[model samples]
Target: MTANPTATEPTLLSLPAPDEWPHWMGARGDAQLAEARRLVDDLKAQRPSEARQVLRVWNDAQTALSNAASIASLFSEVHPDRDVRERAENLMQDVQKLDTDLGLDTELFAVFADLDDTDLDADASRVLEHTLRDFRRSGVDRDEATRARLRELSEQAILLSQEFSKNIREDVRSIRVRPEQLAGMPQDWVEAHPVDEEGLVTVTTDYPDVIPFRTFAHDADARRELVTQFLTIAWPANDAVLQKLFAVRREHASLLGYATWADYDAEVKMIGAGQAIGEFIDRITALSGERAERDKAVLLERLQQDRPDATDIDGADATYYAELVRKEQHAVDAQRVRTYFPFEAVRQGLLDVTGRLFGLEWTPVSQEAAGTWHADVATYDVARDGERIGRIHLDLHPRDGKYKHAAQFDLVRGVRGVQLPEGVLVCNFNRGLMEHDEVVTLFHEFGHLVHHVVGGDQEWVRFSGVATEWDFVEAPSQMLEEWAWDADVLATFARNEAGETIPADLVAAMREADDFGKGYDARTQMFYAALSYDFHVHETPDLTERLRELMGRYSVFPYIAGTHMQCHFGHLDGYSSAYYTYMWSLVIAKDMFSAFDRNDLFDPEVARAYRDKVLAQGGRRDAADLVADFLGRPYTFDAYAAWLAE
Candidate 1:
């Protein structure tokens, strides 16, 4: 995947620097906004050539600003400093303005619309086309007044999103539990975080701390308190943030001349329309609902078997009892699973899989040389055939100031001939809890990494690497998750540091448990997607009330009172009305995986075809076109539904 030296190296201005904090972020933002203004002025003066130069300058500046903002924002989420967060927010606002000034809908499209396809080289044409399509979707074609309003709303939405995430990051709730109450938890977890003077083991809402307590803590009251605290993140303040964000998004969409937020947002997505997505959701819900009901019945029965007098199962009992079900049905102990899949082995497994599938090599870089946000973070030089392709940083473990979620940040987007484009994949998975399933999480994030590193063939920087349809971008990463589950793939990485392979029976047990409670998992995801879409689509005064009403209808479990779940839902800001992308992308991912199943799971010929036809192409062609080309046929939902049966 490494580019030839003759290929353009990505501009240095576009790359993110590690040590430069708030000031670099501010300067980057100013540069981008200044470039955008230059472009506007050039166009107004009727200087076409100067206008084009200005556009290129703006693109480069925007890319750098965006990369810096993403890194700083992620850092502040974990670190929780007010200044860093505010700087990140300010930079984000500058980006939104560029999007508006350039015509969120039309400016991008205009770049491609007037291009003489043959005049520019292939790379330039691809970039131009990508930018054009992006503008079209962003409402660049809207009237001047509407476009102005859209820009304002866009800026407001960014501010609201940052506030929403900040509120959650700053929220720390404490609960007291006796030493005995933590009985079922692993001793390491309890010792790692102990409360002061109250005998309470304080656990934050961070996944590493929260998940284990939910899954293992023996005391019902203690579990209830933690679960409540986890769910109630961002609370009343976040609720207002979410409502404002939704309203801003809706207003932005309406100004762009769409009937609803969903309609406007779906225009550039794979589904193409709100109705199609709604239909897809309806079908999946029907199919999955039956399985979910049966799964819940068996689980509830098992719960009763354990605690005979327990009448109702609520939020706190969900994970604890689910663990019981997993052990009872599959004999797969989470702790035992962790013993085999150590952190280093999982990391090696991910690198190994990418090497095999994409003909790429990853050499670890020193922390001092890489200049990252934290000591634990590592950078890797991605190369192919002895040539540098791109670079990516893997911030794997949870840290104090790191974002408490797994996400891929596009630090420096690739433009053809641009050398050393950079990206970072930030995740908060437990290094200690190295369960077999955690391997899947690693592969999933690596999927995003592969997309960013491999697809630098686009002419325009904007269209480079996983910058396709918003809904379709997840497919490449989602497809990687399948490899993690395959035993053949696991054999390559699922070994001890001492080089002993994990037991076959143990692997089998984990696979069984992987399928266990999948129905419940699907339903839970559906609930979140439904809630996200409903929040954006509804045009009502009381956002909280509407959310409750929708939850009552869509959620299988009863909604807990006094908790504002939407407040902490980060995706609501950007993915509003489009959170269903997860499920939507799964359909395409499953279809793509079917190709490997047919040719050969590890077949180099098939892998090469994918690398050449899909990964190498970036967002130059329509996402569906790439999928169809790679699969040698149109994508269908059959394979996706069939996977659920397995």
Candidate 2:
């Protein structure tokens, strides 16, 4: 793992310095674009006799450009300060335009096209081929006027995507809950939500805030109010923004000779087309749709156990009663289970388990060397057999104006023995001890970081990290969640403040109870997958109505009037045509987990096999080929189907 002189060389595998990432990168964004243009000009100025240096020159420029834009964009999304976010967003627009220009530059593509691939390795050759293909898809082959129009469309897309996501972050609404309404909620949760002078507790739409209130708060009126507000986030304003977004996308797709954005986007996906994605959903729905109805009836019966004359079930009421049924049937206390899984301990346990599985070790960077934007964030260096290989940053708390979900952002892409990749695992877990689901989430996001780091072994920047086909990218992450379910793995760190291990039976019960909502939960995910998938495939004027129709058809609970889940459906912002990627990815994830199922959950042999065949390959191979190599067979849906049935 010593640094390779031909790559970044000399100072490689040094601790990641994300703190070095400019806090307000507005100025840096402009400078980076200027350098990028200069580099591109240099490429054009090079002699025809200089074709030997084309790969090195172009690869270096692309790396610098990507690093700048990614740093700026990531800050724009997650920075705690609004001023920094605004500045970053403003510069990001220009970066996006320059990015488009640089990528679609006919002159640069010609240089790459002129180069002989005979000198390049297989991976570098594949990288160049993909670049050309992407450029063609971007309309590089179009007439001058059409190419110019495509550039305009590309800039508009960058702005609209920014605006659509901004609306989701900036839209503000909160509800006042009466003190009595906090009944049935965990005491810690109750205490966290303090009442103002008016004696009304307040809640916002953040997952930690609203989800707990809905799931455990006994106050029907409070849950109803919170649910309504949560559903309508980015409404009225973003509604039109989304329509415009999709319209532009549809037009963009048409320009590329595709019927819809779904088809246009699926040109490089595992499923191949939106129609195939739809058919997959139809197959699952046919098998599970009736089971969802039965699940709903069971929940309604539980609700009626209290309100004897209850006539209908609202989405808010479903959660309150579902918790009751879980306890009654499976003896699980979702909140009580949190006592065993503190944030710090869970982090340690995750590192330990993954380290043992993959034969790696993690060490925190010295505080002086740990460059961080927020004091809460920390950095760690990953090593294998004493050779530093990668760096990871942890930003695991929620605050006002922060990105509202859990995700891993690749701050730097590494090539083996070259530039060590740096990944930021940003999540919104409770600062307090987390619930088991949050623990699962911690593992899930960590899986992404591992992929970003382990998969960074590739030689080309474009092929580095989690660069697989979009839908299959989540499979490795989801596969890691199985470790969270293992009792032995949890025992490694599932201890309370008192230092007592979580009881084996308690862990067992929570695991069992977590499955109680599977029938309805699977249906809920399917409803979302279909709504997003069907819309992009067949664009229509009445998107809200289409959303309502899908919900009415697939949802376990009846659709509520005046509620608009699509408004908060941020997936539409970027994931529009590919929202089914989650379930689609899970099919492969479940199959991969089968390798470890027959052996020890932490079987090192299986773990190393997964690392070598899947995680380490990145985009070096097609995802199907990787899966086939790992499993020694073509992938199948049998494991996924059985999981759903279970």
Candidate 3:
């Protein structure tokens, strides 16, 4: 199982003490900011050299705060200390303010705009250019009043988003399941949960509790009720948060001189405009809809055969019935796959794959090196040719007060001379034995971890790994999913403690089952992308109404009553109109993977070229140019469309 970092052990958690290293770091940053202000006064007195010193001081202050904020943010969700959480949030805000005062935005733009063709500092030049672009997209170029208003809107939005997320984290619904209702569930799952006075098993709303209950529970009415409760998380307050956030975002975009929020968001993305995303979504929806109808018919036929008296299936039945279909058609069971893929084996397999593909080695670091998020979090040192390159911390699992999302948090970005080795990956996957599909999720997240550790070519921290165009950032990570599907790669790590191998036929059957409901899954994702874009692009006063209208046209399942999914869709503010990045990057990823398919899947030369040209370079070059150069041609959607056809 993918590890959930939030689970509790008997011992006390080893979180950072209030007076740890970051406290000094925070103080140092404040001092530097004060020094910069003093230097600015000196600059007004006509000392040009002193002005340069002030700029350096301001840069130093910004870097210190940035580092502290990154570490604190990751730790805050799981950190037991209230002080640490508040300190981290405060430092992040201070850094945001410093960014505004340094004139770093305009200064960096001027530095890049004046670069000579023959300049050897290409990495630094590219970093400056990227920073300038971010500043412009952030509305830093607006007049004083407009910029202040935009900043206020941003601050308000951040606070609201944080509060919304907190509510979801704390909102736990307890369910009681009798022994008869838990017939098909694994023994460990049934025992792990508590039993109430009535001898009914009580489970919380965590994915570990919710997913198994949805798939294995035999009581139809109980399953339906639980699913309804799960879907309606963070209801009334979160819905209000979404409404206010929508208005704030619209105003922020207007202040930046854009026609719609979508226009403002897509301006700095790789796609160049909002229209391109709309066209791409439309094209995929047409193909996905055809396949979805075919799959839905097959599912319905099976449902009738299994339950001759049942009339219709709804959202709650989807998972349970899908598992039944898999068992009937392919004789594949998710729980059986979990026995073969223990968490430790999957992690080792990923390390082995990276070692071969990128010529790197990993060594475990001391827990102290990880600096106290939780005792279970593991830190590792990444090296190539016996030389240390960088570090990555894996905080896997879920617990109370922890962030309930699966994402990679970049704690410290690596730059050539400016920053030390730094990075981290955060996730909330089950930590015990995992299903085969869960192993694929591991590979996908490891893709992000490797991206962070490989140290890109950019000279500044702002343009480092995973900091490029939002639409293009997913390409490297998505391409790694292909590795999980390969038998050769799977064989390297799919072993028991006694060195026994899993049967080859089981792996093949697992792959077949994995692709079984691709169409339905793809369509569901398309619905989210479409809904997110439509909500941002519309100028209407009611976002929920707009969301419902779009859902009616695009979503296969009927919208559930009394729930607004957008309230919990925290990514709406950040990714906003850029949700199509997932699909766009999938196209590029498929084309990139074709190289390995054409050559041998394990071709050393091909792997080496990919590592050098794409993964290692990061955002030093324009993303389009980098992709073209690596592929020896432009990216095309044929591969993506054809993959869906399969």
Best by TM-score: 2
Off by over 4 Å in 3: 1-62, 100-121, 309-312, 496-499, 539-545, 598-600
Which candidate comes out best when scored by lDDT? 2
Q: Give the TM-score of candidate 3.
A: 0.89
> Model 1, 1-646: lDDT tens per residue?
1112333445423323554656665676566556555545544444344334534544554454455455555545543345656676666666666556565535444534664555555645555555666677677776777777777777787777777876776676656677778888875676777766866656667877777788878787788888888878778898777768778877877776777889888887888987676677667777687777677777678778878986656567877877877887889777666666778778877888889888999998876666665667778888888888888888888755556678887667776564356778888777654755567777888888888878865555666788778898888888888777777777787775566776767767777776767676777777778777777677667766776786665555666666667777778865888888998898899899888854257788888899888888777778899999998889999997887888
Which portions of model 1 show Cα errors greater than 4 Å?
A: 1-20, 32-46, 49-82, 104-144, 194-197, 309-312, 496-500, 598-600
lDDT of each: 0.71, 0.80, 0.68
Q: Which ten residues in a row have the lowest lDDT in candidate 2?
A: 1-10
Tell how far residue 642 is off in model 2, in angstroms. Answer: 1.3
lDDT of the structure predicted as candidate 3 = 0.68
Q: Cα miss at 602, model 1 (Å)?
A: 2.7
Candidate 1 deviation (Cα RMSD): 3.9
lDDT of model 1 at position 397: 86
Write the number of the candidate with greater TM-score, choosing between 1 and 2: 2
**Models sorted by lDDT, best on top:** 2, 1, 3
Candidate 3 lDDT for residue 435 = 61
How many steric overlaps are in each model, in order? 22, 0, 17
